[model samples]
Target: MKVMIRKDSKGTLSAYVPKKDLEEPIVSIARPQMWGGLVTLANGWRLELPEMAADTALPITVEARRVAGGED
Candidate 1:
């Protein structure tokens, strides 16, 4: 899935799922620190997702990391 990360007027960082609209984000990072690094979601899904360019009009493709003991 291609994810879109954008900054709101209040400066909150949010990730937009293509299927869903920007008004509702797939996940919202606590801070910008998670932008370039690996992030573990509340549901325990870890992703090697990275932030893309602000000026770019492309969505990013992310792969969800396999859980330690979970089936692929």
Candidate 2:
């Protein structure tokens, strides 16, 4: 799935994911912390992005994969 990541006018990071990729329509929005520029979705999918500008709109690809134990 593809997601669009950008910083809102208030300087908060935001991500927009398509409903087709989600299990259900989002009942609420959450401000999840980003760890190393990665955010895990409720559908068990993950998105990783590089360092981006505050006003940058980044298009990122999300895929499902198994992580090797303890790998970061």
User: Which candidate ranks first by lDDT, i.e. highest?
Assistant: 1
Off by over 4 Å in 2: 20-37, 40-45, 50-72
Ten contiguous residues with the weakest lDDT in model 1? 63-72
- lDDT tens readout by residue for model 1, 1-72: 455555577765455555534233325343455545555443444445655453444343444332353112
Backbone clash pairs for candidate 2 read none
Candidate 2 has a TM-score of: 0.36
RMSD of each: 5.9, 7.7
Deviation (Å) of 48 in candidate 2 = 2.7
lDDT for 67 in candidate 2 is 26
CA lDDT of 7 in candidate 2? 50
